[model samples]
Target: MATGFYTHPDCVLHEMGEWHPECPARLQAIEDQLIAGRIDGLLERREAPLVAEADILRAHTAAHWDFLSANAPKSGYFAIDGDTVLNSHSLTAARRAAGAAVAATDAVLAGELENAFCSIRPPGHHATPGTAMGFCLLNNIAVAVRHALDVHGLQRVAIVDFDVHHGNGTEAAFAGESRVLMCSIFQHPFYPYSGTENPAPNMVNVPVPARTGGLEVREMIDLTWLPRLEEFKPQMIFISAGFDAHRDDDLGGLALTEADFSWITAQVKAVAQRHAHGRIVSCLEGGYNLSALGRSVVAHLRVLADL
Candidate 1:
């Protein structure tokens, strides 16, 4: 089956600011690289819809939605936290970002596609049940995972987050939910600074130090994450595909490369093939350096599409 690529133009309109690293250009960078690599034509393309209020409520509180709506400016930006901000197009773009994940889940579950990639922003995994932080307004992956379990009647699902920063909000959302197993690798003592402490049993949180590279990442996956994931035997797999760990990205301190992204995708793809009928849904999270983000996404897609 072909891989589904879900994105929306609104995603490009929600700019934090000219100086913010999470600019609208991130989406364009990914597309530019895909076209340059001659891989854009290989996948099925689809526009991401606006997610339903019910779907958004599944992962976030009504109060959170209310706050975002009330604070959405008509022309300027509203600061949600130190780094996170909401402009006029923020809500629409956030809804579409979450919507892309839900649509991708539906497509993969229906066997209309083998898997999907949601190239969206502002990146999620940092936004929590009642709070928005880390440039995220909605927990996109959490909403989709809930939809797969609650709406689709999926028994077991797994979320793999490889962002340089821990997915604190994702961990908070599914902390004790045995039906979902979250495996992650992030820089320790980094932004949000909370993954080193106690974690839920189902959470395989690996906090690698700064400057850690591909060899260590592979070892951790083989020795730690793979075992738990195999035992979990998830019915579906989701990825928080963050590329900030790339050595070229100054936003993060890890030393990962584009080759590392490809290697890790291959590993996760193998896991899906072994246990999940090759069903996977990947969402964009954090990759600030435009060039590295684009190159890394190409490598990731190449593996996901089995090219």
Candidate 2:
């Protein structure tokens, strides 16, 4: 089966501001690169459905959902934080972003697709259950992982977050849960600097110093993440795919390149093949520089689509 490419049009309709780094153009950049690289035709594309309230509640509180929806700005933007904002279409877009993750999970587990990639966002990974931060309003990957564990009856699922910043929100969701093993590598003392502090036994969080290069990142993953993943033997693998770690992206000071992203995807792909019957679901989290983001996603998808 072809790899599933999940996305939605409403995701592009929600905008924070004209100059925000996490603009709707980020999605357009991915779309352009996919067409330019000819990877668009190699995959199965699908529109994302809006998430049900129950799905969002699997990882977030009802009050959290109620607040975001109730407080959505009708004409302008409602500031959730110094950075996170909600416009008329913000909640709708967030629902689609999260729904993409869930639908992709269902598709992968049901064998409708070998694996799936969700290209929707108001990028998720940073929003905790009760707090929305780091330009995230809803924790998309968390909702999907819970869907896999709760609805699909998967006993064990592994979450791999490779964002430049720590996935504090995702960590908050499943920190002590035995059924989930969360492995990550992020720039230390960075934004949402919380991963290094007493992580749970199931968490393998490697915090690299600023300006760390791709080779060192790979070595850390090999030394830290791989062994734990092997031991856990997850029934499904979910990736919080973020490209802001690329050297060209100024949001992060890391020195990773598109090749590094591909290498990481390949490593995760091998793990999935070995332990999860090749079932994997990936959701986009962050990647600011348009050119770098688009190129990096294409590199990652090449490995997934075997192009």
How much is the lDDT of residue 83 in candidate 2?
Answer: 88
Candidate 2: tens digits of C-alpha lDDT, residues 113-198: 99999998898999999889999999999999999999989999999999999999999999999999999999999999899989
lDDT to native, each model? 0.95, 0.94
lDDT of 1 by residue, 64-92 (tens): 99999999999988999889998999999
Model 1 bad stretches (over 4 Å) = none
Counting clashing residue pairs in each candidate, in order, gives 0, 0
What are the clashing pairs of model 1?
none
**Could you list the CA RMSD of all candidates, in the order they appear?**
0.6, 0.6
Give per-residue lDDT, candidate 2, residue 160: 96
